[model samples]
Target: MIETHSSSLKTDQMFINLGPQHPSTHGVLRLGITLDGEVIVKAEPDVGYLHRGTEKLCEVRGYHHCVVVTDRWDYVSAMTNNLVFCLAAEKLMGLEIPARANYLRVAMCELNRIASHLLFFGTYGIDIGAFTPFLHAFREREMVLDLFEMVCGARMTYNYIRLGGVMADAPPGWADKTSEFLKYFKTKLREYDDLLSFNPIFLDRTKKVGIITAEQALDWGLSGPNLRGSGVSYDVRKTFPYSIYDKLDFKVCVGEAGSCWDRYYVRMREMAESVKIVEQCLAALPSGDIMAKGVAKIPTPLPGEAYAHVEGARGDLGIYLVSDGTSCPYRLHVRAPSYINLAILQEALVGLRVADMIAVLGSIDIVLGEVDR
Candidate 1:
């Protein structure tokens, strides 16, 4: 108070809540931000506003029913959620999923990844003050949903990937329709570049704004596009080779600078890879039973534990299942990527402009349901 730092008086740290209502925070997230004038001194992400106790519920429900419960955790990428739980339960039961079922699993999960990224593509544009891109992104997202509805009968919370295999095989004409969609989607990637990716204003707003170094991303346990953006190159599909991912061919896209643009662009490039995987899956669609035989309606697994993980649209989604030779699980745990990835925001948000907080948060692409679960 006695002496000013410059021509103006010294600014005091001000604490403010960013969401649980605000639109830019994405979902019901509440970011307790401490701002020293326009600069953010600290950012604390307050979660559990959407907790559903899904892991606890899984312990009481039958192994088969737990698949549906997994859907709500990451509703944006529900197929991966369905797949991870199924992989864990199947491992515990030691079941051999059919070749066709595995192919279908891969196809569905890849398609789901495309759909989830599209949501991010649209919403992220809106987060940064651009409105046109959201319209185009949703137009394509609806088509993907139509394909999901064609086979699974549910759009968002699809209980398709199951204990032994998928809920059912793809119906007639579904494959051809998906191929047509892919052909059209490949052209739209460039259109996105013109709309948002390369816009001068967008580049200025996102580039070099929220830079997360490769080291920081690793220390915070980031994954999926977040990790890839930081040049980590960790994809469970590529590294662990789950399901039929090893049979398919695709590249792992990464970023150099690890800025907000890098994270956003990683997802954009991943969509192209997903298109390639879907094309290959359709071309090499195996012939066999969709659901494995001999899995009982209410079967019990041996007294042991199994863990399975998949490269979810958000990141490394995993499930751990424990069985005590009963139809119900002895204990269940989830290593939700959204939950783990959200941790970095607490540290990453420091030392940035208050406005850049939204930019950085949007780039990470956290889904509140998965975070709070």
Candidate 2:
């Protein structure tokens, strides 16, 4: 029997689906992956699982009503979404918001930025098999949500920022409460660094995995921390100053190496910088009307188009508005950063192990609501 055996063995590429229901995906996203053994041969991202025709919906709503629509785009950082859309509408109408309103806008947006990053930090830990960090990160994030709820009466999607100003000014003692959170958060950040940033296991998993070159990142339209992680110092707030950011003093955090760890570190440092900007804004907050008179009754602009963008937590969130002298927009388009940033996934996933692929996707920190919108 041992001398009579002659058989053929077959070897073929394996295809696996990593998404549409996976916990680590962070949202409804699917990845069609082809693998050779444990190594990834190719990866294709399948989006649109959460699309709701948001842009088309925006066209039907009135200018003021559209602000609420923008809330759902990047639901985690709705303040910045509101800011960008309101900025575009204000620019088109040629209206000037009050100084105090501008400062308040900056403060709220920075707080929202911290909230979004905390979510990324907590969830990214879960992706890497560290459950403890998720709890710690969310504990800090709840404090941010409390502050937001106090400001706007909503936690996730607060339509607080409006064209020509905010919905209202910060309530009494709001600035003091914000200051307390900033002080407490600084200590929490140090604790986070000690717990995970320097852990040997985390370093091993992320230090050299999923490297993206600076040129590759730029070519792929990567932005925010992802692009800066690749050693590119481009930030929409810095390159194109909007609102009161130009007057604020803060450094743009950049990573030294274009690795998963670098991308993670950049966001960590950015949280600290955001604290600084919020502190400055609180100290410089002026006393004046929160909204411009007659702004609520602003007529449509004279048959023109305008584009306004802000440095959102994910990246550059922009709105292109076209008007034909009508109350509702003739056409509206949103330049969502998450959608653009997620395009690099397929290229980044090649040759990585299945485990490493999860690590890479987690580092990208995408929200499918924004991507599929």
The most accurate candidate by TM-score is 1
- Give residue 77's error in model 2 in angstroms: 0.6
Error of 2 at 104 (Å): 0.7
TM-score of each: 0.98, 0.97
lDDT of 1 at 185: 97
lDDT of 1 at 138: 96
lDDT of each: 0.92, 0.91
Q: Once superposed on the true structure, which residue ranges of model 1 sit more than 4 Å away at CA? A: 1-9
lDDT, candidate 1, at 280? 94
